[model samples]
Target: MFIDTHCHLNHERLRDDLQGCLERALAADVRKMIVVGYDGPSSEEALRLSLAHPGILYAAIGIHPHDATTWNDAIAARFRELARMDAVVAIGEIGLDFYRDLSPREQQYRAFEEQLRLAKELDLPVIIHCREAYEETLSVLAAHPLPGVMHCWGGTPEQAQRAASLGLALGFGGTLTFPSAQNVRDSAMCIAPEHLLLETDAPYLAPAPYRGRRNEPAFTRIVAEKLAGLRCLDLDQVASITTQNAYRLFPKLALPP
Candidate 1:
């Protein structure tokens, strides 16, 4: 079985056809999925999905860097409350996105720092979303080390080593199959199996042949296959390694029998 460590089934694109998506994911052997939240409403929706699905789904709730402007004392309390719920596993999809700069840099840093503290407070791992801010991101993480997964990692091999050294697992998705994403491939090749994870980032970053199309949890199989090919390993090996890595990063994902 494979776990899509990060996806957004709560998003409108997939939620509109949620049942079909779930069926397809199961068919693809992508058994458990973590629906990550980028804001308040989506976080609630993610928790609802996890609660409704039980073993089949889980949640990671936090404010995305894009929505950092929305972060505040009240919002933090609400997220703290949500984080304590059984269905919620982590404190992210949080970090810097210097490329878009959607929220002011000041707010993004503030939100990222505060959320990092919150995750530390709750003793939960994090799901980081970094884009064009590896230096700053790693620096902050170094200052406040914690276990987590760098969702949809697109950093260089050096950055991959740095993240792993800091006890962060690196997630690879459809981008691993992109022709021009050599850096992602190289990073995947360099990271140890224990630190490797598979994700679809579904409703986005669909793999080849499915590229340019809407992504889904089913595509996690494609990512696993690609990672297997890149690592000169069997599909099952890749699946096993990544599933264990997912469990290591998000302890709550490993549901009771």
Candidate 2:
């Protein structure tokens, strides 16, 4: 079975037709997914979506670097409560994003480090998002020493190796399928299958020939197909390995590990 280890099905774009989306995913053999949150409301929604779907979905909660400025005591308290919930699998879709820099750099560091400590205290794995700040992100992670995925990894070969050295899996999604994404393919080829996870980042980076369209969990199959092609492995092998990797990273997934 293929697992979309990252997505945003809880967001408004897909929430309205979530049932249909899931059905399509199931039909496409996309059996499991991780719904991510970038803030408090979305985190709660992710938890709810996971509960409703049971084994078919799990939730990763955190305030994304984009919204790090809003990470106050009240939000932290709420995340602490949410962290303990049954459906919550990880503390993430979190980390640094210098590309957007929506939040002040100092605030991003504060929020990232604070959340890193929270994940350690809660004993939960994390799902990280780093863009244009791979070195800085790795430095922070080196200090905290947490288990997480570098969600949507688009870094260089050296950074990829460093991430693997840190015991972090690199998440690959629709970008892998882009005609201009040979670099992503190269990185995917170098990473061990055990240190790899698949995602759609749904309502976002949809794979071609579905590019520019609204992405959904169903398109994760397309991403998997692309990875299979890159790895020169059969689709079943990619599916089995990546699913195992996802389970290994997020033990809170209520399924066979």
Candidate 3:
């Protein structure tokens, strides 16, 4: 079975047709998913979905770099309470985004540090989101050194090795299938199987043939196919490797089955 380690079923695009998305995911052999949150409401929604679906869906909650400005003591307190829930598997969709600079650099740093501390305190793995801020992201991760996946990895092979050395798994998504994303493919090839993960970042970044259309968890199969080809491994081999990697990084996922 394939596990879409990062997706957003809480987003309106996918939530509106939730049943259809879940069915297609199952049909595609994508048996599980991690519904990621970027902010307060979305994190709550992610938790709700995981609660509703039990073994099939799990949640990773935190403030994204774009929403870092909203971080504060009360929000941290709320995340602490929510993290205690059985369905909230990790603390994430959290990290830096220099590309957009949606939140001030200082605020982003503070939020990232605070959330990393939160994850450590709760003993949960993380799911990081990085864009044009790999150095800063990697630097923080090196300092914090929590177990997690670098969701939708877009770093160099060297950086991929750096993150893996820090005990973080690198998650590959639809970008692995893009013709021009040779660097991403290269990173996928270079990483060890134990440090590899698969994700879709659904309702966005759909893999080829289905590119430009709304993405969903079912398309993780396409991402897996691309990775398997790049690494010269069978599709099922990639699936088993990544699924075990996901379960290893997010121990809560292993609890269900």
Candidate 4:
């Protein structure tokens, strides 16, 4: 069985046929999925999905940096309330996204810090989304005490090393399947199996064969294949290890029988 450590089932692409998408994923041996939320509404939707899906799906609630501009105490309070839900496994797809600059850098930092504190307070793991702000993200993480995974890891070997040092598992996705994404692939190769997890970031970063198309949890098998190739291991071995790693990070997930 495989685990899609990060995905957005609450997004519009998957919302229409959520059951079908999950069926296809299960057919492909993708047993468990962590549906991520980026903002208030999405986070609530993620929690609702988790409730509907029960053991098959779980949730991670947080506000994305893009919505940082509108973030306030009320939103944080809502997240804290959601975090108390049994199905809420982590506090995330949260972090810095300097590439988009949708929200001011200061606002992003403020939101990130607040969420980090929330995770720490809730004693829940985090699923961070960082883009083009590795150093700044790392700096903030360094100043905070939290447990989490770096979702869709797009960092250099040095940064991966630092994140691993802080007990943060490095999440690999379809980006590693790209031939030109040497940095991401190298980072994947550098991470130890125990400190690594697999994700698709669906319907976003689809793997090679499905490149340019909408991604799905089923495509996570391709990600496992890539990681196995990069690590010189078998597909089943990679799947087994990554699945175990994900369970380690999010103990709320019920493992496949």
> What's the CA RMSD for each of the models?
0.9, 1.4, 0.9, 1.5
> Could you tell me which residue pairs clash in candidate 3?
none
lDDT, residue 119, candidate 1: 96
Per-candidate TM-scores read: 0.98, 0.97, 0.98, 0.97
lDDT of 1 by residue, 24-136 (tens): 99999999999999998899899999998999989999999999998889988998898887788899889999999999999999999999999999999999999999999
lDDT of 2: 0.89
Candidate with better lDDT, 3 vs 4 = 3
Candidate 4 residue lDDT tens string, 155-181? 999899999988889999999978888
Model 4 residue pairs with clashes: none
User: Which regions in candidate 3 have their CA more than 4 angstroms from the true location?
Assistant: none
| Model 2 alpha-carbon miss at residue 207, Å | 0.6
Candidate 1 lands at a TM-score of 0.98
| Clash count list over all predictions | 0, 0, 0, 0
lDDT for each residue of candidate 2 in 1-257, tens digit (9 for 90 to 100): 88898999988999998989999999999988899999988988999888888888889999999999888889888888988877889998789999999999999999999999989999999999999999999999999898899988798877888899999999999999888877788889997788989999999989899889999999888888888988899999999899889889888785542
Query: Candidate 3 on 1-257: residue-level lDDT in tens?
Result: 99999999999999999999999999999999999999999999999999999999999999999999999999899999999888899998899999999999999999999999999999999889899999989999988989988999999999999998998899999999888888899999997789999999999999998889999999999999988989999999999999988888888887763
Lowest-scoring 10 consecutive residues by lDDT in candidate 4?
A: 248-257
Better of 1 and 4 by TM-score: 1
Between candidates 1 and 2, the one scoring higher on lDDT is: 1
- Position 64, candidate 1: lDDT: 98
